[model samples]
Target: MPSNVEIKAALRDMRYLTQRAKELSGTDGTVIRQQDTFFKVPAGRLKLRDFQDGTGQLIFYERPDTEGPKLSNYSITPTNDPQGLVKVLTDALGQVGQVKKERRLYMVGQTRVHVDSVEGLGDFMELEVVMEEHQSREEGVTIANQLMLELGVKEEDLIDGAYMDLLLKNQQNAHAP
Candidate 1:
């Protein structure tokens, strides 16, 4: 599995953060609207990312649900038939949750800085420091930490779970009358 050091946090100001990220980044960022549909799986978390350009990818990933940066191992499969896949997966594996967001992606060295406006969940930031096949997890974590500090991510705003998990929790609470 390919790996990266990842962190997620509550975003206070997307505009300010994006400007800071642009200043710190070497390349211009790309913004895209995304819809992530998660499905129940026997092992690992699975989701398909559907983009506005009709492109999609199925991702299966596993990472420790801990605050701060952690190593995430993942596999991705490109898909052309996302709608069909969603229908089949929903019937077979059951749909778990979904997240819709507008994401601004910026690359700082080998790390990806994400400023996202998530529907229902408000603003958020995520960092993914891509690791080389020969790279140690510690090295990736260090990169993530350095970038986090550079981008003004505070320790208190760190979160352990994915957006889908948070959305699911909110849904459960809403129905727990």
Candidate 2:
């Protein structure tokens, strides 16, 4: 499985973050709109990510839902038939939840910086510092930490889980009261 040191945080302002990222990377970044349909799996989490460009990826990943940078092991398969896969997966595994976001993606070295506006949630940013096959976890963490500092991500804004987890929690809360 391919891995990365991942960190996610709630964003206070997208404009400030985007500017800071641009200053550091000097790239305008790629913008994408995505909708992820999650599935209930026995281990880890599975999602079929459909991009607005008519492409998609079937992603499965496992990681502890921790507040700081943590390791995530994942596998991804590109699929052209997103709608069909979504239906089949939903039918076989049962749907968990769906999350929609517009993302501004930037690359700094082997790291990917994602500035996202997630529907029904809020603004957020994620850092995925991809690791080489022989790379140590410490290397990925070090890179992620440095990028965090460069990007001005505060500790207080760090998040504990994925967007699906947070979205489901909010839904439960809404229905509870």
Candidate 3:
């Protein structure tokens, strides 16, 4: 498993690459909005992610939700492979409810910025700044900030809670309503 530091560095690099690609293609940096519904099965975790840009993909993540910040995820584009990977997981777990959210994704420097609002949850922002081979957190946070600005996100809009927490709270309100 890669340490958070290492993962952060790699993400920064990926951001840089993505930005360069956009420039080369003569396209302004783009944003992607998406909503993802996740289901957990006995075999693993399955997710159906829908991008507002008219694209969707299914992902299967097998990592145990152990206590920690480390999360491992792998995705398979259903458009390319369709039934192969998705069927293996869906056949095992059963369907979990659809999680809905709108996410704005942007690239800045060497990082990826994700500003999101989840239905029944609230507003949240995530910065995935990839580091270079020997970059530090300070460098990564700087890059993250750049991307945040590109997306017009404010630090105050950042929420520390997870989606499930917000969902449960919303559920309670619905019950009372």
Who wins the TM-score comparison?
2
Question: How close is every model to the real structure, measured as TM-score?
Answer: 0.95, 0.97, 0.51
In order of lDDT, best first, we have: 2, 1, 3
Higher-TM-score candidate of 1 and 3: 1
Candidate 3, superposed: residue stretches over 4 Å from native: 1-29, 42-45, 52-54, 60-91, 131-161, 172-177
Candidate 1: misplaced stretches above 4 Å?
none
lDDT of 2 by residue, 60-168 (tens): 9999999988999999999999989999999899999899999999999999999999999999999999999989999999999999988889989999989999999
Residue-level lDDT of model 3, residues 64-170, one tens digit each, is: 34321223335465544333434555577655555676655555455554445567655555555555657655665565555445544444444433454457667
TM-score winner between candidates 2 and 3:
2
Off by over 4 Å in 2: none
Q: What local lDDT score does residue 82 receive in model 2, on the 0 to 100 scale? A: 95
Global lDDT of each model?
0.90, 0.93, 0.50
Cα-based lDDT at residue 107, candidate 1:
87
